[model samples]
Target: MASPQPLNGATPKPKPITPSEISAEFSHHDPTIARINNGSFGCCPSTIIAAQQNHQLYFLEQPDNFYFNILKPSILKTRQIIKTLINADHVEEISIVDNATTAAAIVLQHTTWSFFSTLFQPGDAAIMLHYAYGAVKKSVQAYITRAGGHVIEVHLPFPLKSNSEIIVEFRKALQMGKANGRKIRLAVIDHITSMPSVIIPVKELVQMCRDEGVGRIFIDAAHAIGNVNIDVKDIGADFYTSNLHKWFFCPPSAAFLYCKMSDELSDLHHPVVSHEYGNGLAMESAWIGTRDYSPQLVVPEAMEFVSRFEGGIEGIMRRNHKKVVEMADMLAEAWGTELGTPPDMCSSMAMVGMPACLGIKSDADALKLRTHLRVCFGVEVPIYYRAPVEGEIDPITGYARISHQVYNTVEDYYRFREAVNKLVKDGVNCTLLPLCEGYAQLLQMLLKSSLPVLCISYCSAVDV
Candidate 1:
């Protein structure tokens, strides 16, 4: 594979990179920053971004023609591709939405007391993992409360030893609910947990829910679309939602919601009851008023671009998973701590335990650490509160999660490693850290500091 060169000569091109060098192919990210936070909001590949831009331009050129004639077919094609990628039973079962959050909201609103009377009623219990995304938890709480139900938190361990442990915890929750005489109606589980970056056994979880007599299951697969192989039907979740912007390599506001195609969901509609709403699941989601549909239009292109990498889709997934494990291992050894998750339980993202020396106290401290890394070190990674909601409390505040994408290299993790090492060894007081010190003085301080630093030089003057 010949390395892709800049059209201009000023930018010297490295030799054609193998599949590992795929990061060089994406031009949208800031060249100066080592972006290791792809799990939060995915970075779109160059080709897919271009495809979206072209579609937007086309829409602007002829609004009536594009919306009335072109948009429906384009959306249908994208949904079809997504359906096949996830092994969904039917194309119509998938509905394009702005994001996983929206997809989840739609499901919650329709299934709760607001829409369905038989499903979620007063005093019904909705089950969820303690590791569920806060936003989705809030969504579930809102509808369940309105319907006069409460949420049952199934506490899954962070440093999980085995998948059987998760099943045991869930079984306990089910038994407790049963003893209380409360009906366990719904469960909102994760395909990949956001904070800890653990790969959940969705298939086993779904089966467990079924055996426990849970009426419906919703799988929040926000980080699973591109990072993990999705078999939606095989998982047997009644509802599933994923974001294309995160792992599917699509533009913002690109996501889909899938509902099992059966008599159970024959009348469910999109959250937004618009004029274009129809009786069918896909038809109602097709026209959610006028909005940018370009992202939805480019799903196939994103799939093609990633698939064209040296090893194709399977290859891309394998490389990312391996890279993240390698990255996690290095970081863990450097910090003298274990990788929070086992290699087999992790996909393209891994969360490593932070050093206890840094005394991170609050969410503010975590944010400061993240910002300091970005501003002073030019490394972008997520530092979060891994403090679990239940069970034993952790002594440290949280772990820092690294997301490995096709557009990343080992060099990026190296940059992050160096930065973390400096922070732990030197202990910069984030509370009083100065931003934008005089360039010359900054250089002098960098030279005088006891800890060796990687200095990036740039000049700017503040007004007297």
Candidate 2:
């Protein structure tokens, strides 16, 4: 979404958001709905949004100075801050991209095709888990296919019982690839999955890749930053990318890519070549043509704002993790369904199973359910449909992924629970349920109406 131009020709300094003022902090959101989908696009505080507006106004005020002189310095400063935040070795290795997908694409597209051919030949394989994001997967497949390489998809079952299971499955895939005379070239793994919302032990996975002769590893940490503690140097991944908008409280279109400073990567180029064509990774990425630099500029302010919370960013992460667990447990128990991953394996987001009978056959059907939850029931959460894996028996499932941020309350989850339960019982038609009945009643009666309106109407309606 394009940022709206500032109103009244000036940006106001709004108060910083605090934990207690969670819901009130974000006035841009639809108040009637409980926003449990922060994992998709993060909720930006009004203060940060105002700061972005100010930066925009400043850019237009002196376009020449801002673009030629001030912009580079400001961007460099933000890179240094991000370097310290993610524990990168140097700012020069970091490039500000629009999002993680773009970052991954730059790495794949900029590298000399000859080098990729040497690393991954026609029969050789590049590995990615089945749970990898669609965009990341497509980029890898396209690049690898063009280079005459095949993909080895490591299948990971949802509702997994243990983290060790992931390690075992990965090792098996590596052995299978070796047996087929397929040398594993590059492996793409997520720090936290987008759909199931499970936190993979990336540090361990990186070591396993090294031991198994996987040439390079790309850590897709899109949902990892504010949710999981990060130490990029310690993780020792060849490449890492994460979205500031998702968790670090920055506006959309702001994310950073970190490449291990190496002589080999000195020739890397930005995807969009411009006047700064051959100026190395950092410079090339900085001048990817004229666009909104506000998202990248106000990153420091977002970091400072998050640090001002109760125990700072650490406290916020802890609170969010706890809230997600609480919500996941409540909904799982209500639906008599299992969790997508174990409790300890999840961070700020968790996926709880839904009845497969929801009849969510396509993406459109899944989206309709999500919309019904939002528009009719005033509940905003992500709904996913996981098709049955080849080896599983009737294991097909639907899932509700809930995200918890500082600007969220348990009351929001309760509202979500009430709404979802009602939807399920009405056979996903959503036409039979009172739609706004429970939503309105919750406002009038709050927790007091939980038994009659929420429990009986939604929870108890499901079979034990």
- Best-matching candidate per TM-score: 1
Q: State every prediction's TM-score relative to the real structure.
A: 0.86, 0.85
- Per-residue accuracy of model 1 over 1-464 as CA lDDT, tens digit each: 98677688566632434554465458657876789999988878777778989999988999999988999899999889888988987898889988889888877876684324665556778888888998998999898877887788888777776778888888898887666577888889999989877888889889988988888899999988888888887899999999999877888978999899988676677788877666676777778888888988898888677656656677778988999999999988988877777898888888888776676666666776776677666788988765545564545555888988877878888888887777666764444343343633564465456655553322222111
Model 2 CA lDDT for position 45: 85
Question: Model 2, range 1-464, lDDT digits (tens) per residue?
Answer: 97576787676445655555664558778766688889999978888899999999988999998897888998999899889988988888889889999988887774326346464466677788888998999998888777777788888877788889899888888887777667887788899989777888888889999998887789999998888898998898899999999998999988999999887577677778898887788888888888998999998788778766767788889988988898899988877777888889889999888766565555555665675566445778888777666786555367889898877777888887777666566655422233344544553354333443332323333221
lDDT of 1: 0.79
What does candidate 2 score on TM? 0.85
Question: Which segments of candidate 2 are over 4 A away from where they belong?
Answer: 1-21, 110-112, 115-120, 356-364, 389-396, 427-464
Checking candidate 2 for backbone clashes, the offending pairs are: none
